[model samples]
Each structure stands twice: as C-alpha cells, then as structure tokens.
Target: MAISEKELLEAGFSNRDVDTLLERLSATGGTMQGFIAALSRRFR
Candidate 1:
C-alpha cells in the first residue's frame, strides 16, 4: 500500500485498524485516487 506509516499514525489509527481498513478498501475496489476523490466529494 502506498499509504505511508506516518500518514496513518498522524490520522490516529493503530496498525491493526490500518490493516483492517485497507482490506475493506481493496475488497471494495478502492484505490488511493478513488479514495481521495470520494473523500473530497463527501466532505465538500
């Protein structure tokens, strides 16, 4: 995963949570680009 350890740590996720979230994202066909795009739209 391109998701950095620093980014995950800064976001306050434990290593375990990061693994679980990544699994969910990948299973749902989520890429980093798609994830960011979705977040932007939802938060905007």
Candidate 2:
C-alpha cells in the first residue's frame, strides 16, 4: 500500500519535505522504498 500525504504529515514531515519526496519519487520512478533509501543517503 502507498503512503498518503496525510500519513506523512501526521508522521511529522513538513509540507516541503512531502513535496520533495513526491518529486524525488517521480524523478526516479516512484517507489517508496527507493525514496527512503535516497532520503537516507541524503542525510548521511
């Protein structure tokens, strides 16, 4: 199941973070796991 924007917001992500995540997913073909990996790399 895909995570919703409401879920992200409720999970503590800001609006900008949500937008960035969506954009990243779109740019790389939209996988939530991949997005998480990329996000992890970004922070590390």
Candidate 3:
C-alpha cells in the first residue's frame, strides 16, 4: 500500500518538511537503514 500526502500531513509534518525529507532520502540513494539511523540520531 502506498502512503498518501494526506497521511503524512496527518502525522504532523508540513508539506515542505515532507518534501525535504523525501529529497534527502532520494539523495541517499533510497537506503532505509541509513535513513533510520540518521533519524534516530536526529531525534536523540
């Protein structure tokens, strides 16, 4: 199932933040592990 933009918005992120996160994820070559690690560090 695909996640919709409305779902993201409902999760409390603005469109710009979501877009930026998507851009960063794409720039990382779609590596979910690295993304999760980065997010962990960020939230910590």
How many steric clashes between backbone atoms does each model show? 0, 0, 0
1-44, model 2: which lDDT tens digit per residue? 56688888999999999899889778978787666676679999
Q: Rank candidates, TM-score, best first.
A: 2, 1, 3
Off by over 4 Å in 1: 1-5
CA RMSD for every model? 2.9, 3.1, 3.7
Model 2: residues >4 Å from true position, as ranges?
Answer: 33-44
Q: TM-scores across all candidates?
A: 0.56, 0.65, 0.54
**Model 1 lDDT, residue 28, Cα:** 92
Candidate 3, residues 1-44, lDDT tens digits: the string is 45556776897989997788778878877754566576679998
- Positional deviation of residue 40's Cα in model 2 after best superposition, in angstroms: 10
| lDDT, candidate 1, 1-44, per-residue tens | 35565697788989897788679888997776676577779998
Index of the highest-TM-score prediction: 2
Worst 10 residues of 2 by lDDT: 30-39
lDDT of every model, 2 decimals: 0.75, 0.82, 0.73
lDDT-wise, the better of 1 and 2 is 2
lDDT winner between 1 and 3, please give it.
Answer: 1
Against the true structure, candidate 2 reaches a TM-score of: 0.65
